[model samples]
Target chain A: MIGRDEVLHVARLARLALAEEEIEPMARELSAVLEHVERIGELDLDGVQPTSHVVASSSKVDVTRALRPDEPRPCLPREVALAQAPAVSDGGFLVPSPQA
Target chain B: MSAEVLALSAAQASAAIGAGELDAGELFSFYRERAEADREAGQEGLNCFTWVAREAPGKAGTRVRETVPHWPDTVRMHESAGSSLAGVPLAVKDLFCTEDAPSQSGSRMLEGYTPPYTASAVARLREAGAPLLAKTNQDEFAMGSSTENSAFGPTLNPWDRTRVPGGSSGGSAAAVAAGLAPWALGTDTGGSIRQPASLCGVVGLKPTYGSVSRYGMIAFASSLDQAGPLTRDVTDAALMLAHMIGRDACDATSLAHPQQIALPSAERLDGVRIGVPAELEPEGSSIEDGVRRCFHRALALAEELGAQVNTDISLPHAPYGLSAYYILAPAEASSNLARFDGVRYGLRAASSSKVEGATDLLDMYTRTRHDGFGREVKRRIMLGTYALSSGYYEAYYGRAQKVRTKIAEDFATAFASVDLIATPTSPGVAFALGEKTADPWSMYLSDYFTVPMSLAGIPAISIPCGLSDEHARAGANGAEANGSGLPVGLQLAGPAFSENKLLDAAHALERAIAFDSTAAHV
Candidate 1:
């Protein structure tokens, strides 16, 4: 079960600000989701290795694809890369200062 | 007039264009008119597209020629190669980035943000000469099942305007259904494409995971996401899948080897063994009477056509798919969505006027995401952050992964005895517009039947089997009570790389049922 405090904590972790009225409702919704998902814990998965990716690899060695060769390739031009930036400054993306 | 060509399956349209029976220009006009009509029709118009291209390719000064510089090499390769998908117009779900059109992913956060490239799947479609006609709407970041989570507003069901078309690929499904375009691209992460395609009475194929490259397609759940086609029938889906699938270095998770799927040569499923999971029966789960009736009738039809239908198969862990999907998808979503910080692409909350309200940089990040994301998006993000948070990881995400493994093993075990599995794509027909919006759990449960295949990373197809009248009468509200003649989808799933086999079974079922998919109004 989740509460308003947990909701706020999670929001902080996700870097999402919640309005005052949204906190309780968000908590309620999250609690419902948790309750629904909690059913997974009832079944014992003693030796099951979790599947991170569903790549169709029949053998352990073939599961992971070889990484692409590290030859340097052409990257997106600066103007194109910055096209969608909300704030740009001196050909670089701008954000609020890291230091508070 | 446009209805004739619009009604043609993508394969038919392509062949017509290839044979010179249908000119690309006229086909484009038909699709353009239909797109404009749908856009103008407002609420009843299906409202399927987020952005409709003004002119089709081959026209002087068209968007394709104007935007070729931003397109990847594959798309540019076909620009000089003349018409190839033989000029069949393609509508794309907004989740796939098209350099010419704004790829908003049905969220206000990325409004008007045009990516510098096109999705690899879409590039292949272009390479095959499928003209881009429009960009369809979807759930915000492919989150909701009803498409109601769209900031642009929900797409009305073409079948019955009052009912939903299903989501987050609702627009793509509805567009194809209403004859706006011959076929469209849709991504499935926990049944986005299949469920909506089922509800809208079209053929939707969710290819085995990693079969199609996801490059330039906005990420929702990294591991679960796979792009496929929403078409009028099985053959068209096969054609689109054949063109769209290939290995791409841009997406590391893309398949190492290209998959080649072609139209099935056999007309009947003589030796196919179709497994009907016992847990999915109406007596056990919440499947509606109407859907159950249609499913049984389709199974009977399949049996008559030489396929063996086995109803005793038990997938004990299949029912846990929804829970596991919710946990795993959100955990990945929380991680995938972290790139949307205010500094880079997408909307930012920080502004000169809002500076007074924010305390610092942290405040900006918080406010930006909070203000940008919709209610459902925030809810999932919060849930995912909680699950992946330190100390809670093993309890939620880790356990969900194990359940995913169990579900995959269940399918593997079942497939050893049977060639394919059968179920109703959704439990019921589409509900009215606002019916289940308040209850996210109810909406999530709509995908219960289709989520298991997604977890198992298998191929599945949803095809129109029959019409259901139950939701029209004694269902939720009178809005759906008029026997809206809603279409019911029969889902057929197979093991990984079994697209040809799955499509063969689906084509057999399709020919047997002979369900008319034409919307009354369209």
Candidate 2:
């Protein structure tokens, strides 16, 4: 069972607000998810080094390469690239408002 | 062939088309007819799809112009397409963006939201010769074990109407198993692809992270997710893999090393050594007797094929694999899924419903994510946020990462001696729909044999081992083991970028077992 303060804390951590009506239901769901997480906590991992990269880091393969000198390359024409744009002004494609 | 051409595996279709036995157009129409027929049969009951595309395969501009449905339709028309892969019909997991169809990703939140660009994996397939069929259903945000978590309703397993097709790649598995398409693309994070494939008794490969490009895959658990091929046979799977891999500028984790992978042509069990983890096969774990017998039979077949099989290998840290995976998967998922904050991409709750201009962008994010994502996805977000939050971070998320490291190390220590790890892909055959829903423990346990590989970021595939005698004895309704009555799977797994070898060994078993005709759907 989760405490009232614990429920509120989970909601805040998850960046959600719960109504009084939703609190009990939300608390049950939250408790179930946390219980599983708690089950994950039973493991003992003393002196084990953490692995961030799934692929083994290699000095040869993973070395940061020097920036290549600019070479002439094929490029898509601006007009063709901009053909699908909804709006354009002053040689620039004008996109719609993300807020809208 | 009447409708048999469309149902043929990638290898079969390509071979026949190249041999002048079958035509690409015939293969296209067979699936076009079947997809239409099955949609009619399944749309009401299975809920296995979000949207069906209006266009048929073999059209121009489908690779880049259409949604990133894997293996573009246009390339199949190329005469050179008959080289490696001539024609294989494929279904896309709805999570990937497809231009012609809506990329809903199984959420009411993104209903009818078409992406502006096609994903790179889909582009690669189009460049190869495979035809893009349709988009299959998935869990909202690819979260649930059963595809029941989809906003559109659950995807029922093809074999039994009541049981689930394991998800979030449920529809992809179902489409392949029920012969809607020869193959499909599925994203696996913590056994999304493997579990569904095991339940469906089809071959699903969760390629090593970074082996395949995620340039167009919708993010669920960033650290864990990898796009892979799911097909009726390992040969078809290998051909599909050869088509959709290599480095991509759009994805940083994309493999710098892209080596040509040969499929069943390269399958060699001779001189191969296998490791069987003792923990997975331990008695009384809900793994049915049929699965165990089949696993043993597969092992014996491998041994008979001149492979050395080792049993009783103890990777003790593997015992904690599920624990580590749950923690890291949810932790990564929480952070990655925060992008759907109703600000940039997807739906936002209406301002009129808000408290008279009091709510802002943050309020909109909290409301949309809280309401939009399914219960499992939401539950994970909350649990992960709490784990990543201050005061609890060191105790939960931090320690889980440590356990994850230990699990990887344990596998490395074992793999030093053995070439690959083998287990029963699932503990048992598919279960009833509501059977495990009441208890998440059972649901998590469903992937017990498979999760360790996902946590280690290795490749794993499930090939049908044998059939369930129990289901056969009771006739039609006894158990929903699999549509083909196969209850067994030889869960083959290998370390990162070891797909070529894994596919080779899986092909060896596929031939040795000789269940291809009996096991394949339609």
Candidate 3:
């Protein structure tokens, strides 16, 4: 079952801005979710390998090989790049502050 | 329009377009206008989209069809996946990056961010002549069962204003259900597409992993996410899926499997075998009464059409599916979501505004992430991070992986007995808005049936079986798709890479229910 503190903590982490009225209802609902998920505890998985994906027939890509080749790609002009910027000063794009 | 034309499956649409009665341009506009109207009606509630594609100047969503990639081996796809449907009006879940549109993934952090290149799936869809009409809404990073977790407001169910559209693909399903788009694209990781489909009363398919490219789909659980279509019917879904499928060099995990479905052939279910689980699916445990009623009716209908149905079968470790899914999905999500640190790609809060022009990198990262992600997403990332942490890794993530192995074994055994295991897509139909929003556990439980398939990476589709009484009240918001009679969706699953039989069985049963039951909503 979901604990109230856990729910509140999760909400705080998620930045949900949930009101006081929502906590208890959420706790109750979350408890149901945990209970349902706990149903998995009923199975005997002593030797079972945990399967994360359905199809398991492929090799992982080499991270080093993923880098784009040195083929010279076209670059947009500096002014063209800054054209869509909402605000620009000096050689940089400026953004508005969220706190204000 | 002839009933045949209106009734045209995706395969049929392409064939008809190829044979030349309907103009490809006209077909795209017909659906686009419908989508435009759905958007207009649903603007305040569904939150179905963040951005609609600007009107394509030359094509009107059709000009690029002549450039569609040739697919000779799959004629049905070439017919449907390649033509008007390719250029058709449809929405993509905003989780995917598009060159021309913003991909918020339901977060404020990435608000207004448009990538330089489109996702691979989007590129393939475009190459096949389908244009991106709109960016459908989704849960943040595809993390939650409901779109309620979106940093953007929740996407309401199209069928009932007061209810939720199931998520993280809720917006896509609701858009198609509300007739906002001819079809829309969505990702399914633990029932993301299918659950919402059941709620909205439309067709939602989660193709087997590797069946479709995940290269462009924004990763939630990298191993589990499979992009599929929310079409009005199974055949259309198959056709569109065909065009978007094939081995992509970009996706290392993609399957080079060759399993092409024959649309309209779903009408033959005689030899089709279905497995009913004994343990994982207890009445009142994971299923509700109405879903069961419709499931029984569907099974009976399939039996009437000569299919074999097995009961009391043991999917022995299947019960552990949910536990395994939670551990694995979050572990993957934690890893996938880490890329959003405030350096690039999305919105950034003021580095200059903090404490009188104090400049530091740490504050920027913390403030951006803290403000950008929503509650469910943040909770999941933390949970995933905890699961994957050094001390907890073996106890949680490792242990969960072992459980996943067992779940897969049980599924393999069950499939050996029969081709598919059938169950209600969602426990109950769409619940009222905010009913389960506060409770993350309940919201997670809503994905019970769907999560297992994602865990096993199997293909499953939710086809409307019947509707509820609430469907009658759906007319208030111009819910044209809410049939006067309630709609129920019958799910069909097949062995990995065996979408042919799955679609075939579903199509056959769809027709047997009535040579007359062939119908489409918005």
Best candidate (score: lDDT): 1
Ten contiguous residues minimizing lDDT sum, candidate 1 chain B: B74-83
lDDT of each: 0.82, 0.71, 0.67
Q: What is the lDDT of residue B308 in candidate 3?
A: 91
Best by TM-score: 1
Candidate 1 chain A lDDT trough over 10 residues, lowest sum: A57-66
Better of 1 and 3 by DockQ: 1
Q: Choose 1 or 2, whichever is better by lDDT.
A: 1
Candidate 3's TM-score: 0.82
- In the range B1-522, model 1's lDDT, one tens digit per residue, is 565765677788778877878888888888888898888766656789998878767642133432323324333332222235767778999989888689999998898988887787887777677778899999999999999999999998877777889999999999888777888999999999999998999999999888788888899998999999998888888888877775666777766433357676667889889999888842234888888899999999998889999988888998889999999999899999888767778888745213334356787788788878999999999989999999999999899999988888888889889999999999989888899988889899899998999998888999998888775533332344434568899999988888888888888788889877665336
For model 1, the stretches where C-alpha displacement exceeds 4 angstroms are A57-63, B59-83, B256-259, B281-285, B350-359, B473-484
lDDT of 2 by residue, B118-195 (tens): 667776676676666778889888887778778877787766655678988999888787777778898998888888
Best by DockQ: 1
Interface RMSD of each: 2.9, 6.5, 6.7
Candidate 3 ranges beyond 4 A from true positions: A1-47, A50-53, A57-100, B1-13, B40-46, B60-86, B280-286, B351-356, B469-474, B477-486, B514-522
Mark the 10 consecutive residues where model 3 chain B has the least summed lDDT.
B66-75
Alpha-carbon RMSD, each predicted model: 3.3, 5.0, 5.6
- Candidate 3 lDDT, B311-418, residue by residue in tens: 856766656677767777877887787776554356555543332365554455556666677667666665666556557576667767776666666678788789
Chain B, TM-score, each prediction?
0.93, 0.90, 0.89
**lDDT by residue (tens digit), candidate 2, A1-100:** 6767887787776766566776676567667656655765666667766666566431123513423336554444565445433345566644334253
